[model samples]
Target: MINISYDIKEYRKQLFDIVNDGNVIVELGCHVGNTTKLILDKFDNVKIIAIDNSPEAVGKMEKLADDYSNLTFISGDVRRHEILLEAFRLTQSCDILSVDLGGGYHPDTVFKVFYIWSSTFKPVHSIIRNKGLVDFCNSAVVGCEDFKSHEGHLESYIDEGIPPQIKEFELWTPSLREK
Candidate 1:
C-alpha cells in the first residue's frame, strides 16, 4: 500500500522492513532510481532487476546500471509482451517482487500487474506501494500480530494474506445458492 507516512524515516522503515535477507529484487517502477538506489545501498548483496517505463534522460539508466554491477535495468511498459519477455529472459524468478508503479497506483492496475508478476516469479515476498491500497487496509478490521507473511501467507491464504478477493472488484457473481 502507499507508504502512508509523512515522515521519511517511517516511510523508509516501512519499505525496508519487508526486505531483510532478500538479495534478488524485481522492482517494477524505478522512475528515478531513488528507491532503487536506497535498496542497492542498504543491502550489500542486493541485486536489483529494476524496470521503468521512462528512459527520460540519455544514458540515465545506462549510467546507473554501469555503476552498479549488481543492477540490471530494463526500460519498457510492464503491460507489453516485449517487456515481459525481457524480464523473463533476465531471470525466471527473484527473491522479492517490489511494485511501486506510482503513488496514485489504482487497485485495478496493481491487481493486474501483481497477478502476472506473482504468477510468473513466485517470489518469497511481494510488496506494493499504492495510495489506493491504504483505503482497503483501513477499511478492514483484523489481527495485526504479524501472521506469517509473504510466501508463508500462501499456506494460510485468507488468514494471512487478508482478502485476495476484494469487495471493490465485485459487482455481481454466480451463486451456487442465491443470496
Candidate 2:
C-alpha cells in the first residue's frame, strides 16, 4: 500500500514470511482480496476478520470468502472505533493484524490505526503499508522532512512499548506483535 511500487508481485511477496505465523488474523483494507488470497492459500485453518470501507471491495471479499468459512468480512470504515468493536464482537482476540490502506492513507492516520489495533488485539504479528511512516523511519538525512515530522511519534510509540521494525523491502512493513 505504499505510494509507489513498480513490481506489485514483489511488493506483495514480502508479506509471505510475516503472515506465516498466525491463525486468527485481523485485516484492514482488503482491496480486491489480493492479500486475502495470499493468506487463504497459504494456510488452511487460518481465520480472518477483514474490514474495508468500500462496498465494492467488500463485495469482492464476499466472493473470496465463499470457499472459506473461516473468513469473516465486514463492510465498514476501519478507521472507526465502532467498526473495530463490531469486528471484536466476532472474536475476542487476534493472532495477527495486517493493514494495507493503500497509497492514499495519510501517515498519521495509518499510525493511529496501527496503535489502536495493536493495543486492542495485541496480535503476535502486525504489518502496515504506509509511505510516510516508512520514509520517516528509513531516512538518515539530518533534519529530513519525514524524520522530523514522524520521529517523535515513532519514538513515543516505542517508549509506550511498541518498538518499530524495519522491513528489508520498503513497500511492506513487518513487526513482531509484542506482548
Candidate 3:
C-alpha cells in the first residue's frame, strides 16, 4: 500500500474531484509515482500521463506502471514547451493538469523558469476549453518582495538577492481567475 502524506492526499482529492469521467490527466514533475499512484486509485477510468525529467524518477514511475494499466510514463522536461505540446498532442484535451515543478531552492531562477514554461503552454486555460481544471501546487513568486523574507528550506522558496523583473507574469491561481 502507498503511504500518502496528508498534504498529498488533499491535493489528490482536489484533482480527482475536478476531472470528469474518462478524461485525460497530465501530471508534470511526477517524482517516484507517489502522487500518480493516488491519482490512479482515485480515478480508475481516467488516463494518466506522468512526466519527469530525471532518469531515476522515470525509472521509478516505470516500475509503478506495471500495476496500473491506465498510466503512461514519459521522461522529459515539462519546462520545454515543445516536449509538453507533443505529449498533449498524443491525447485529447486534458481534463486536469497538475503542476508540481520547481522543487529546488533559488526562487528567482525557478520563478523565471516557471514563467517561461507556463507562457509556452497555458495548461490551465488551454486544457479547460470546455470547462476543465488545472491544479498548480507549491508555486511561489520567485523574486517578489514578500518572498525575500522567506527562509531557505527544502520545499520552501529561497529568495536570492535579486529584484523582481518588470515583465514578470503574476502567479496564476484559482481565486485569481475568479476575480
Candidate 4:
C-alpha cells in the first residue's frame, strides 16, 4: 500500500472529492490533524469525529478543533471495543468513514475490525488504506468502486455512490466477540 504519489495534499483532495456538505466523517488514525484540518476546511456544516491512538496526535487535533467547532477528537485505540462504542455513540452513519490504522497489524486484520464495528450502519462511501483490504471489504459489502490515488497507483479504495441508511444501528462489545 505504499505509493510515492501519496502525499498529504493529494490525500486531502481525494477525501474532499468524496465528502460534501453536511456529511459526517468518522476517521480512524487522525495523526496530527493534517487530514482532519483539510476535511474541516473543505466542508462546511460537516461533522467529523476523528480518533487516534496517540495522545500527541489527539492533542494536535485538539488545537485544530479549537478553530473548527464542527470537529471532535477522541484519544484511544480504534481497535478497542470501548473506543469504537464511543465513536458509534457520536455518530451512527457517515457519508465517509476513512481508516488507516498504520502498519502494526495486517491490512486484513484492520479491515475485519472496522467491518465488524461498522456492520450495523453502512457508510455511503469508505476510504481504506490498503487495496487488498478494500477488496476483502467489497466482498463482505457489495457495490463499491476501486479507486487509485494516482492513475496507476492502487494504494487505497473509495466506495462511491449512495448507500441505504440504517434505522437501528448495531453496536458490538468486546465480550460479544473474540479479540
Candidate 5:
C-alpha cells in the first residue's frame, strides 16, 4: 500500500495495484527512484526496466537498483528513438508501461514516442501523466477505453486492457475521445 504523503502516492498505489508477480514494467522517466523504490518494495518478483536522461537521476536509480536485483536502469533520454529501441530490446515486452516525463516543451513528442512504444510493445496497461496528454492519448491511442481514476479528477488516464495497434487515419488527424 502506498501510504506516502506525496499527492501522487495514491496514483502510485493505483498503478501498483494493477501489477502482478513476474510482470515486466518499463518506466519512461524515473526521477530519483521514488516510484521505483515503491514498486520494488511492493512487488517482490517483478522486473523494472527504467530509463532516465539525466545522469543525476540515473545515479539515484542506480543506487536504488543495487538494493533490488530485479531493477535495470538505462541512462539515456527516453524521447530518443535509439534509446527507446534499446529499451524495447532490453525488455522485449511489458505488462505495464508507466510514463511521466514531467510535461516537456513538446508534449506531442512524448505522445508520439508513446504511440510508437505502445504500438511496438503492446502493453497490457498504460498509466500516463497530465490531463492534456491523457486527453490526447484517449483518442489517438487505439483500443483505449476512457478511464477516469476518480470522479472529476482529470490529471491522468489508465488503460487496463491490452492496447491495439496504431491506425493509419489517426496519424494524420487529431481527435479527442468524447465522453
Candidate 6:
C-alpha cells in the first residue's frame, strides 16, 4: 500500500457527504490503493471502481482488495477513453470521480487525462448530480500551473458556447482550495 502523508480522513468525509450511500464511485490513477482503502472504510455501502495503468500499482491494489469485496480493481490507462467508457458502462453512472493521476511537479499527463474524461463523461444532471472533485497533492507551483491550465481550458469551452456539462468543479491543493 502507498503511504500518503496528508490527512485523507477529511477528504473521505467530504466524499461521503457528497455521495451519500449506495452510489457508484470511480477513482483514476489509484496508486497502491491507499485512498481506495480510505474510501471503502468510510463508505462501505458504495461500490468503488479503481483503475491504474501500472501493473505494479494494480498488483498493490489487488492486495488491498483481498479483504474488501466492495472494491473492484481495473488495470488500464485512464488516457484511453475506451477504458473509461467501458468502466462507466459497467457502472452506468458514478456519483464521484476521483482523479489522482501521477502528475507530480509537472502535469502533462494529468491534464490530458482530465480533459479527456471531462469531455467524454457528460455529467448526468439527474443521476450523477454532484460536481466532481480533483485532489492534487504536490508542490504549490505545480498545483498552480495545473489550476491555470484547467481554468483556461474550461473558459475556452465556455466561450465556444458548450453547455455546462460539469455542474461545478473543485480543485484542491494540500492546504488551499482553488475555485
> Against the true structure, whose TM-score is highest?
1
Per-model lDDT: 0.65, 0.64, 0.51, 0.62, 0.63, 0.53
Q: How does model 2 fare in lDDT?
A: 0.64
Give candidate 1's total backbone clashes: 1
Please give, for residues 135-154, the per-residue lDDT of candidate 4 as tens digits.
Answer: 55556754477653432112
Q: Is candidate 1 or candidate 2 better by TM-score?
A: 1
Supply candidate 4's per-residue lDDT for 152.
Answer: 17
TM-score head-to-head 3 vs 4, winner? 4
Candidate 2 C-alpha lDDT tens digits along 130-164: 77767776764556444321211232333243223
Model 6 TM-score?
A: 0.57
Q: Model 6: which residue pairs collide? A: none
RMSD of 1: 8.3
lDDT accuracy of residue 36 in candidate 2: 87
User: Which is the better candidate, 2 or 5, if ranked by TM-score?
Assistant: 2
Candidate 5 on 110-151: residue-level lDDT in tens? 565565565445577766654455455555755666654321
Off by over 4 Å in 4: 1-10, 103-105, 131-179
Q: What is the TM-score of each candidate against the true structure?
A: 0.71, 0.70, 0.54, 0.66, 0.68, 0.57
Evaluate model 1: give its TM-score: 0.71
lDDT of 6 at 58: 64
Name the runs in model 3 displaced over 4 angstroms: 1-9, 102-179
**Number of the candidate with higher TM-score, 1 or 3:** 1
Per-residue lDDT of 26-103 in model 1, one digit per residue for the tens? 888778787777887888777788888876722677688888898898888776556766786777667777777775
Pairwise TM-score winner, candidates 4 and 5: 5
lDDT assessment of candidate 1: 0.65
TM for candidate 2 is 0.70
lDDT of 5: 0.63
Q: lDDT by residue for model 3 over 10-107, one digit each (tens)? A: 55565555666586766666878887887677766978788888767967898887788888888887655455555646663454555555334244
Candidate 4 accuracy as lDDT: 0.62
